[model samples]
Each structure stands twice: as structure tokens, then as C-alpha cells.
Target: MSDPVTFALTVLALLLGAAVLTALFSGAKALTSVAHVPLVIACGLSALLAIFLVSKVAGADTPQFVSAPVTWFAAGKFAANFTIAVDPLSAMMLAMITFIATFIAVFSSGYMRGEHGEPDAGYVRYFAVMSLFVFCMCGLVLANNFLLLVGFWEGVGLCSYLLVGYYYDKPSAAAAARKAFLVTRLGDTGFLLGIMLLWKLGGWHTDLTALFDHIAKNPPPTEQITAACLLLFCGAVGKSAQFPLYVWLPDAMEGPTPVSALIHAATMVTAGVYLVARCAPLFALAPDAQAVVAWAGGITALLAAFIALAQTDLKRVLAYSTVSQLGFMFLALGTLGAVSPVFAVVAAMFHLFTHAFFKALLFLASGSVMHAMGNVIDMRRFGGLRTVMPTTHLTFLCGAAALAGLPLLSGFWSKDLVLESLQFGAHSGHPHAGSFYLLMLVAMLTAGLTAFYTFRAYFLTFWGPTVVPEEAGHHAHESPSVMTVPLIVLAAGALFVGIVAEPFTHWFSGFVGRTPSIGLAAKLAGAAEVAHHFNWGIAGVSTLLAVGGVALAYMAYGAGGPERVPVPLAGVFALSRNKLYVDEVYEGAFVKPAEWLAVMARVFDLLLDSVSRVIAAVPRLVGVAVRPIQNGLVQFYALSMALGLAVFLSFVVFRAGR
Candidate 1:
């Protein structure tokens, strides 16, 4: 009955109610005008609750509020509970989810409206599913148990599938939905298995706090913990769109733009990072798993950035950018985990927070662009939008600068923390210093690529000659105030959120209960006294790289530049443009084999059916042959009985003779 718990319950209830109400009234035209009312009320209440919880936890030391565990099912020592907990981490995530989701909902109100300013036909359903999406994420952040988290995790996945394929009639949209669903399911299977393994190996308890306490008090074997952590990371890889499983995310752009923003920014994709953070206790015991996570993240960041460089579609560029940024977060987690487990979690969380603002801003701004341009998202066809949509142009520029990790932007602060964490690991006398150095190199290169591609998209979209398609040219104009307002708010966050980096990192580190140790890099470089100080050298290197990238982009795509700049290595550009044929590789390796197995299964099924029919015919044939023997006549029956007796006597005599 604590205030925080009460507020959280109230928030959950209101969101649940809004979801139910919207779904109930989705198909009712008469209620379309009022469908958003419940969501508005729910969002407002949730925002207030989130703020209250965050304020309560902001200054408190080790502040954690947990609801009394309600046993859902119990047999012997095995049990599952319905519980909720909010510490600084969960509270922060709750605040961001509610706050960002509220604005996105408001933006959608304007964006999803019909051409004539009426509500779209599926308007109610859109709001309904969106509200449900928010509810699921809330459940996830508040969940105190693994089972609950998994439930909410799958709930968000289901909602994403629903929202992504909202336009069911569009073949691409439907396919994208299925792709996202099946691909994530692959990781989800691993996640589920990990949970089961943890339960079996550690204890029967599924409560996260309890499980962490158990694992910490009585540490398990390295192999067991490592296997569990790796399994859990598989889910993260799929959900966050890491290498090999990342193909689904770019295609997910087929959904409505708001849905895309939600996925990329606030909700599903970030779940993997949160999972790792939540399970830091486990990962701390599994160094091998931690290395795998870090390597996967680093590799993904570089690969996705390269792909983004060659993408022509606005959303696809952003999608790949999201994948790359997520990789950066994982890399931070992995590197820090090696040097300081607590710092790794904090660093990753910091990036996740900043990324939410800038990435969401970028997506919404792109939506605004699409709105004005009659849904044309091809950057090749867009140019000089700054002259027409100044507000959107400025807001989008803020987002782009932040994403590029320009000095003082939100991304600069977070991304540097990641790099610094790597530096700490490289010089911390860890056995894997060489590997950390290699990761750092890749991360630095990815940063340059990020800046290059982001501004490349920006310059192509807003700075060149005004050259929109003829069909959309006449209609290009600023988006409505509703949509632009969110952009402005998010842009402000992207610009100013970096200022709180020190306080936020300090608070988060304390909350997680582990302070990062100073690495040997400061000592080796003869700056041990200022080891805790900001690494100006690292910052300078990253900034120069970013500047160099932006300059290169300008030279290539700025006003009056070449129609198509000749790539130095045309084959490399071609490969990048084709996503290095990763999809084709998967199709040939996995998909084709799966399809062949399915065909073989179908042929086996047909053969089995034919054999079964042949076996079945014998009984039918016997029945048909014996049908005439059952004649209805008392005299015939008596004669048949007498003949039978005579045959029996004959048979008995023959047997005795034998």
C-alpha cells in the first residue's frame, strides 16, 4: 500500500481500461470521435504517476519499492508470483515510456487522420492497439518476476506485430509483420529456455529480486550461469535487431510511421538492453557470455552503420541507424561488464535514455516530412525542405546532430561514456585488453560512419535543390501543430539531455551499487591524478571524426553537388546498398533449407495418406463382400444353423483322424 505502488497500480489500471475501451469501440463509427478520450485520460494519469515515482526515487539511496508477492500458482517449492517493483532504473524507464508514448499518441492523432482531416477508418483500432502497447511496456518495466517480464515481453511483440501490419491489405506490411514476429520468436525461444534453466539451477522462484539475491548469496557454477546468460542474450539479439537477427527491423518500416517510431525509440527494441541490465548480477559471474555480448554489439554497430550509408529511403536509414545505435549500447554493456559490471549497466542505460529522445525525434520528424510530401519517403526525391518546413527542418537537424554525437549533444555525452568505458577496460589490466582495443577501433569507425550517414540523409532531404515529385510537390507544407509540437519537445531533449550526464551517471551507479574503478589508461598516459576527470582526448578524437564525416557528406551531397558522386570503390558501395547480401545469405542458408524440409514433409504426408487409404480399403472390401450373408429369414437362419452344426461335426471327425 506504499504510495509508489498505489500510483503504479492506478497507472496500470487506467492504461488497461483505455486499451479495453478503445478495442471495444474500434468498429463503432459513432464512437470514433470519442475513442481517444480514454487514452488521453489514461496517458495523463500515467504521466503524473511516472513523475511521482521518479521524484520519489530521484534522491533516495537504494530506493526500491516492491509490491507484496501474490502467489499465482504453487506446488511444493515451485511457485510464480504477481509482483511489481520500482527502483531508480525501473522508475526512470517508466517515466520515459509514459512521457514519450504520450507525445507519440498526440502526434498520431494528427498523422493518422484522413486526407480530409477526418479520422482514418482504423483510427479507433490504431489508438486501441497503441494504448495496449503502452500497457504492455508498463507491465514489463514494473514486473518484479521473470515470468511476468516474459509475459509482457511477448505482449509487446504481439502489439508490434499488430501495429506493423495495421494495413493488412498491403502485402508488404503483412509480410513485415510476419517477419518481425517469426524472427523475434527465434530469440524468444532462447529467452524462455534461459528462464527455465535459471529456475531449475538457481531456485524455483521466478521473482527477479529474489532470484538475484539467491544467485548473489549462493553463486552457481560459471558454466550454468554462462549458459543462462547466453540464452537470455539470444532474445536480446533478436529483439534489439543485432547481427544475424537484424534483418526484420529495416523491413518493419512498412508499418505506420508512428509505430516505427515507437518500436525504434521507446519500446520493444530497448527491451534487450534492459534485460541485460536487470540481470547484471548473473552476467557478472559469466565473463565469457559478457564477451560474446560485447563482440556481437560491436560488430553489429559497424555493419549497420555501413548499410545505413548506402540506403536511399529515409526510414530505412533511420531503421539501420537504430540498429547501429543499439549495437553501441550493447558494446558499452559488454565492455563495462569486463572492467566494472555496475558501470557497464549504467553506461548502457544512459545511452538507452538519450537514444529514446533523439531517435524518436528523428522518426517523428521523418513522419512530418512524409506527411507534407504525401507519404513519399524516398530521400532521392526530396530536397530543400528547409525552405518550406522550417520548424521540422530545425527540429530534425537537432535530432541529426545529436545522433551524430556532435559535441554537447545528448548522443555525444552517452556515446563517449561508452568509448570511455572501453578505454577503461582496455587499460584495466584485463586479459582481454587487446580485444577491447579492437572493439574500440570498430566503435570509433562506426561513429564516423554514423555521422556521415545521418547528415548524408539530412543534406539530401533538406539542403539540396527543391525537387519533390510532381504529385507531392504541390501539397508540400508544414505538418500540423500537433505533430510539430512533439518534434520540438523531443529536439529539446536531444540537445539538452546531455547536460545531466554527470548527475544521472552518478545516481545510476549508486543505485546499481557498483562504482566504476579508474583504469590504467590514465596512469599510462601520466594523468592518474585526473583519472576521474573527463577524457578530453577521447572526446576530441570522436568530434574530429564526426566533423570530418559531415564535411565529407557535404562535399558529396551538398547543394549543386554531383547528381551521383562516383564512389571510389563502386563494388563496396554496391554491397552496402544491397545490405551486403545478408538477406540473400540467410535465404540461401536457412530459408531454403526450411522450405525444402517443408516440401519433404508434405510429400511424406501424401505418401502416408495413400498407404493409409490402401490399408483402410481391406476392411471396407470385407464388409461389402459379407453384406449379402446377413439375409433376413427365420427358415434360412434355422437351415444355416443345422448346416453349421453338420460342418462342425465333420471338422471334429477330420481332426481326430489326423
Candidate 2:
């Protein structure tokens, strides 16, 4: 009986209200102490509401009424509206985001507590910002118009800045926050310009559904369309941390692990994937743009996977893994010219859904490891923790296996779809079929890299002799129930969600394909028919790659071997370990130049200030010369007047003589 719009709004209200209330009482110790309680409740209800909305949309034969348009503002030809809209795509995002956030909130209750089981100083602030993040992400997916979506996009960015810098006193955390903000803004700038271009091309319609209809009715030039879509994707490149823009995500680990889990898995980073998928109609018209996306994603996947292989920091490995997995999603999306846009988007989103679970599990599990190791995440610092932290080890194993794309797990099912999409693209007889084939090869290689690094981190941390780091003292133990329970729940999702949303039945694809924009795009492109079936051969190949990588990892590290570089491969290992010098390149190439410019600007400012001071000195000199006449003393004033009269008489006599 609940209206989709109302339910969506209610969920947003609950989260936003939680943020407001918590912030209002942040000074009250009693209230601040239990901030996570309100967050859990709000997020729990949000999950329920999201579920209701998803079911309602999934069951509807036609597009359900999500919102009634209300104009918020109007310019000469463009307008922005305050409207909520939900298609199957947004509904699925809503369900996944809210559910994952609920459990994360529960985990934070224990994770944010100080070492003595007391609420930390920023406990309230953390929950408040977290609540705001969920609210922004929900708004982003549900907004009916591009302008509204962009607003929420930046809102989430702000929330990330706050949460990532929760430990503001630490230089690293503060720098990470700034890096995340500034780097993503680089993409956001492109995104905003792309939207403006779209608006102009589509008769100035800002509403998504309307804009798509307008563009289709009167298609713009192919070159313009390509430019707009590519520009928009530039935003995705920045926000999603693709290739050249991916440096900030690894450093983002400077924040609390819970925040890292939320941003990397469930919220901020996923926004880019969601944005691209949301605009599938626009992308379908731009094959060149799609090819760029495919190439960029492919390179990013392989690049990040390679870097992850040599990382000793457990969270950093996972961070690079997150980047690689995101590349897989982009790769699926990039198959537009060779595959149905609807199919491509559905495949991409399916991976997004499945990846969220295990990635969150991996991150939270790492947090558990950090907890037991006295906050040290370095793999070489301690080993053989299988017995010391049994529950953590088990949960982390589940997550690692899932991330490695082991058969029958969530990752396996979704990864198979990604590979299948690429395979289909390569043979689709499109002009770019050869390029698609090349990307498929890169993707397969990346898969092996993914599996290798994931389990490499796993084995190094949990499979060695029970060596506890000095940081852990002698009391290393499993995390508290509050944390482990979420792990169990998330681990279950990571293990089974793919099957539950199985592709064979077209359950996941059908639900997402029902998204109105996707349907509109398919109709516009004349590719309305769904043709993909599960490819056993693709599945077999991917499974082999995953298994091969895992085997290699076991041979290298499963026996608790010392971390060492082979003499011949030392050069390779060093390159990967140094993250291919991407950061160093940026430092020398971008950061240093920018820093020098800032220094130059500072010098310019000081010179201008000195010039102004010199100019002002003239006035001061004039004042000093006239000061004797203006003195407050009566005698000084009279003497000055008499002297002035004498000078006036002398001047008159001199003039007469002349």
C-alpha cells in the first residue's frame, strides 16, 4: 500500500533525521554515547522500506508511479524539479545500500569504541556523518533529475571528507580527506559540464526520463553525443577511482576501517558505476565513448590487480582489489556497441550488487584483523593467526574466497557474467569487435591477478604459525560479537547472494532491465530483445584462471613462507610494490608543479603587499609634514598661523619684485 515515492522519502527522512538529532545532542554524553543505536535503527528501517519499494517495482507490470513532478525552479529553457523516481535499477541500489549500511552500523557500535570499550571522542560525529552519507547516496539514486543527482553526489563527497578525516589530528587522515575531496572534484567538474551539454542537446530538459525522450526524438550529432558521454564518464573516472585517478582510494585507508568499508564497498565509490548505468540511454548512442570506457576500465583492472599482488598492507591490498573489481564493472558497461545496452548495464549492475557484499566483508574482516593485531595491518608484522583468531580467520576466509571468485560463491557467479558479456561483445560482429576481444584477454589476465593477490593477503595474515605481533601484546583475540555478527551475516551474503539473484532465471537481469531508462535506451537503439544466456565456456575459463591464481598463491605463501623477492623477478616485484610509481609520477608531474605554482602565488601576494605599503607611505609623509599645525596645543596652532601670515606677506613682496 505504500507509495514508492513516500517510502523512499521516508527512508531518506529517517537517515537525515538521525544525523540531525545526533548532531544536535553531540555535546550530551548520555545521548552521544549511544549514537550508533539510533543509526542502527534508522538504517534498519531504511532497509525494510527499500525492500518494500524493490518488491513493489519488481512486481509491477508497468512503470509504477514514483513521484509527481513539482517544479523547484525554471530558467529560460531549462528547469530543475524536486521529484523522486524509482525504477528497478534505483530500487536495487536502494535495497543493497540500505541493507549493507544497517549491518555496518551495527559493527561500528563495537569498532568505534575505544580500547577500553568506551565510546571514542568523535563517536557521535562519526555516526552523524555516516547517517548523512547514506542519506546522500539514497538521494542520488532516487532523484528524478540530473541536477538533483549532482547535488547529492557532492553531498556524499562532503560526507566522505568529514568521515575520512575523523582523526583530524593525524596528518595522514587530514591529507587523505583532502585528496579524496579534490580528486573526485576533478571528475565532478566533467560530470557537471556533461549534464549541461545534455541539457542543451535535449531541448534543455533536466529530468532524466524527459531528457532521454527528447534526445531520442531529435538525436544530436554523433560527435556531440560522444563528447557529452565521455565528459560525463570523466566524472566517473574520478569518482570511481579508475586508472590515473585511483591513487586516493588506497590512501583513504587512513580513516577508520568502518568508514573505509562503507565508502569503498557500499556508497561513495559505487556512485560512479550507478551514474554510468543510470545514463545508459545516453551512452548507447556513443559507441566511441563506450570504447574509451572499456579500454580505461580494462587497463585500470589489470593495473590495480598487479599493484595489489605486492602490497603487504592488508587493507591496501583490498583497496587495490576494490579498484580492480570496479574496473570489471566498467568493463561490463563498456560493452555497449557489441552488446545490448540493457544487457551490458544489467551485467555491470549485477557485479556491483554482488561485489558490495564480499568487499564489505573483506574490509570489515581486515578491521577485525587490525583489532587483534594491536591496530597493525602489515602482513609481515604477524603471521599464523589461524588459532589465535579463529572466528576472524573463518570470516575473512569466506570473504577472501568470495573475492577470489571461487566457484559457487557470489563473486564467481557475477564474474562469470562479466566475462560472458565480454565474450559476447568480442563476437557481436560490431566494428569494434577486435578491440573487445583484446579487452577480454586483459580482463582474463586481471582475473588471475585478482585471485592471486586476494588469497595472498589471506594466507599471509591467517595461515602462518600463530605469530602474534608485539602490538597485540599477549591478549590477541577475536573481535566482539557486535562486529563478528555483521561479518557472519555479510559472509553469508558473499557466499550465497549470487545464487539467490541467479542469472539463469533472468531474475536479476529482468528486474534491472525493467528500469525505464534502460528500456527507453533499448528501444532507441533498436536492440530491445534480450539475447544473452549463461556461457559455460566463459565460466569454465574464468574458473580456471581463479583456481590457477589461488594455486600460485598457495605455492608462494600458504606455507607461511618469509616475504621475499625472487632474484630474477626482483625488478617486477619492486615495480608492483611501489605501485608502478603512479604516486611518484603524480608527485613529480602534477603535485610538484601545483606546489610550485602555489609558492609563486604566495610570492606575488607578498610583493603586491609591499608595493601597497610603499604607496601608502607617501600619504603618511604628507601627514607628518602638516602635523605641527594640527597639534592640539593652542600656542603651537597660533605660532603656526602667524608664520603662515608672514610667509604669505613675503610671497606677495617677492611676486611684486618679479
TM-score, one value per model: 0.95, 0.94
Clashes found in each candidate (C-alpha, N, C closer than 3 A): 0, 2
lDDT of each: 0.84, 0.88
* Candidate 1: RMSD to truth: 3.7
**In candidate 1, how many clashes are counted?**
0
Expressed as tens digits, the lDDT of each residue in 288-326 for candidate 1 is 887889999999999999999988899999999999999
Cα deviation at 259, candidate 2, in Å, is 1.0
> Which candidate has the highest lDDT of all?
2
lDDT by residue for model 2 (33-132), tens: 7888778999999999999998988888885455888888887755689887878998899999999999999999999986789898899999999999
- Model 2 pairs in collision: 384-464, 384-465
Given candidate 2, what's the lDDT at residue 591?
Answer: 97
lDDT of 1: 0.84
